[model samples]
Target: MDKRVTYCTDLEKSVIMSNFERRGWIQVGPEDEWNFYWSFTQNCRNIFSIDNGYRMNDNQIINHFPNHYEISRKDLLVKNIKRYRKELEKEGNPLAEKMEVVLPSGQVATRYVHLDIIPVTYVLPADYNMFVEEYRKSPQSTWIMKPCGKSQGTGIFLINKLSKLKKWSREAKIPFHPQLSSKESYVISRYIDNPLLIGGKKFDLRLYLLVTSFRPLKAYLFKHGFCRFCTVKYDTSVTELDNMYVHLTNVSVQRHGVEYNSLHGGKMSVQNFRLYLEGTRGRSVTEKLFADMHWLIVHSLKAVAPVMANDRHCFECYGYDIIIDNTLKPWLVEVNASPSLQSTTHNDRILKYKLIDNIISVVVPPDGIPDARWNKIPSVEALGDFEVLIDEELMEKEENGCRPTKNSRYR
Candidate 1:
């Protein structure tokens, strides 16, 4: 087997350890070795974890996290998205509304984009040009444009005037947007009249999810995750970027919300809000919340099974953000392969640590296997970037591959 050690990093690493401990992982060591190492076991076999985010199998450590989303493979996530988009539409779901377009012309990369549109919905939107003319003819009615694949609620817009659309198509024709609209693909929809409310503010539900077994396809939902509210109060005031109160769910933006309050508003654990919503909005809303959560994960997984079932050594976790309209119906907002691992609070550390702990336990062999003790660092300078865990200075090198270098220096 290729024995190079692997390291994985996310802000959740620290918290994941606590989870490990909670699950009964034992920590053994300060062993004389080149790098820090830790071991834990389950089902009679030992599983390993590295203290840093380095992976033994990859060439270079990624300088950034959250930039890449790990799905079955590089192009798999987008392909899976296409499958799910078809599914929701086939079921005749109300959110199945769509748009049509003629492109500028180029190869279409289906794996990266999937939008919902229709040839025949009860309230049909004719082809792109007709939809535009109808809007012009009506003078008062408007439509929303949502682009697939972009995240954090970006690229969705409300177009009221024909001039704005002329500008959009013009922008799409630019050389820089080459792969986007060569013409054949587009998904347009009527915006929701009522996005759900919290603190009198509009927001979406961020439910955390886990895939325990993908071969047979098993998933587990944490009882809670978080609720991200748009920072502005609802208004016809024109949804500009700043009116985040109705548009953004990112904690980074919402914290600056007009209705923003760090202590009691922008962020609230799902468990806490379960009570708040019930006391105010009534118990039924919360009931639908759970129902919607289950449907989303189940349908999303089913949509992507064709690809996931055929892979091994690939990851299977996902973070799905779902929005519930005023009617309390759920709509899939986006799916994340590498969801945020940055622990935002003490609870974050606790939850994250436990998650990693579970991950390691699953990897350890069920029977006792050999322990490959590794190398040692020559000086404190080697441990760079950490304050509490490292000492400073260098000394010796060893040849055994499992022994620590023979000395130290900090004075």
Candidate 2:
């Protein structure tokens, strides 16, 4: 029987379904009838989802193809910066040394470091009171609160006063409803008071990352992502603390602003941002900044590669949000597992449409179905704007008497 691909009911109207249709891949009905399944939920047979583990995806690649290939058995969904920071703190990791923080008590802290690439984030309930005490010491500093699993700026707020957090926590407390009560936790991080501003507005980068394999750790970075900007100019004054339009760069938050531009969508391409940086910061500085971003991504994946459960049938395209500080440093804000693909502007439509298309080009084989018997990396022609960061198979080849071709620069 010819293998066909099927997606979950939720994705019936999603852009990915259309991308698959464009590729001429036969889409089967939701009758649990297909050789390949594209789903957001884990544990479906022959599936591609965010999670992979014993019960998660049955460690299917290992159980099904033990002799064929070895898969790394770890969880790669990097949603929690707190846990991610812990992983990077292992002895000898170079990022560990660069992200040190001094506590109010005069002790040095490196447990939450990511090479000056992240704000000092602490998981709540456990670190809640300590964070409150820290805030007490630095009343003038601002901190942002983010729920562990929520995204799109949901359940996010800024806390400038310790008393407000205490009152809010008290109001959120419930006796029996554990799920509804203060039992719900958050991560609070020191806000970057000074972000690199464009046109007097705060903005962030939404870069695309495609990970095809984990055991071999094959990953790619799409070069065509754009910078999302706030509709209002950034303001750090106490009076503007509640103005999400000035503080947050989320499209959901900014779209409500009166000045939100529907034509340009209050966003610009990363390439244009790069050009602007080059014009202002010089080419060498701009080049180093981009290189540093690339380095941050490659090492971030490397930190979690060992624990990710690899499934050949599964591939994930992550949206990595990054912020550039005033000193020309790129700080990783967060990573989204299911980034919104909806486009709100002409440029957005063009970029996202091509992003999905390019993702299809890189992932799907020429035959419309991945050959279960073999694994092959995408060629440069199929990569579109995606650049491969690392390919374990290629590394293995070089280890076993293969010399890199002149085109190795692209690899």
Candidate 3:
């Protein structure tokens, strides 16, 4: 029997196509029989939709889960995380321990310390009154408003005053009805004004995580994730509020700025970032920061695992955007279902190409064939630059010291 993997992809990007070509995978149309499909998030929805009535065999696999928005959508992510924390608190988990947090107005508030990775956020206009209440408590605090469905720092702006929100709503012709279900919904989060700066400029980390399953979640973190730097220096003056170049570290937004550099594409390697942190801050503190980041990433996935579809044929590579404050606290900015395949520089191209190659290796079985029924765990040789983030099944086995019986079905 022919064992060459037949693949299909809706994307025309070189990073993805080249990887497929390098593996000698035959290209097939979406409607044709194929073992693998690299699909867009929208295409995934269509493929998995009940109306489409599409079914996959054990030999087929694809990227993205049916309900990935559980942790990808800005609003849903916050809702799921809040729900996860509450459930943990109800179970009396020490991980959900509450701690006192000081507000910008010098007032103190108690919050779940472990899950406090994300900033104080409220989805609007449903939470309009709640946002107002929180805003009044810290009248001087700056909050960033982002469209729930958008990406790449689009439709994002900072507001330090209530009037700015009102003016924005009015000018954008957005209805303030509490029952509104329009796609124009936004999430307003407290801005981390005092971000950790490198070379006097602000940047955000872009970490890639690959999830093979949701229930008994299996995940891997890519080691070569990079940091996207803002083209301009960090500034907190109210006058500079509209300067996206000063606040947004998204390469798409930064590339439009006059200070954008083509040579380096305004990016820094995460290794260099760690070195700088360890050198500037103490090594222990820097280590703790990275540890905390990993903890939050795992918990964030756990938060939405209950809601994820967890289809056997689906696996997703997510881009997690994170920002670290001046105090070395890493904040969960957002998660992307489909990270950009577009490389901005030569190094970036190589990194992303390797990323795609590693993803294929880990997802495909040892035979180099896509098989959804195969155990999700890949051999150490397949992991390339990716490190195992979590394997709940392996954790369970280690904790119990029990091996599966012959009759037991492998997950």
Per-residue alpha-carbon lDDT of candidate 2 for residues 14-108, written as tens digits (9 for 90 to 100): 46677767656666654544444444432343333234322223111111221111111111132333355555566555555454566655655
Residues 1-411 of candidate 1: C-alpha lDDT, one tens digit per residue: 633333333232555446434544343332322111332111001121233442322121111112123242222344465556766678875444555543223322121112331111111112455455445444444455655444444655666566776687777762223333343234454455467776567777776555533434534455556777676766555555335446667766666655666554466677787788688778987777665556555655655654542222222335667677766666665566656666666666555555544434333222211121211121233212211111112221222343454222110
Per-model CA lDDT versus the true structure:
0.46, 0.68, 0.91
Q: Could you tell me how far off, in angstroms, the CA of residue 275 lies in candidate 2 after the best superposition?
A: 0.7
Task: Sort by TM-score, best first.
Answer: 3, 2, 1
Badly placed stretches (over 4 Å) of model 1 are: 1-6, 10-13, 16-149, 153-156, 172-189, 239-242, 256-259, 281-285, 358-411
Using lDDT as the yardstick, the better of models 1 and 2 is 2
- TM-score, candidate number 1: 0.57
> Candidates' TM-scores?
0.57, 0.81, 0.96
Query: Which residue pairs does candidate 3 place in steric collision?
Result: none
lDDT of 1 at 214: 43
- Once model 2 is optimally superposed onto the true structure by TM-score, how far is the C-alpha of residue 88 displaced, in angstroms? 6.5
Q: Judged by lDDT relative to the true structure, which candidate is superior, 2 or 3? A: 3
Best-performing candidate as measured by lDDT: 3
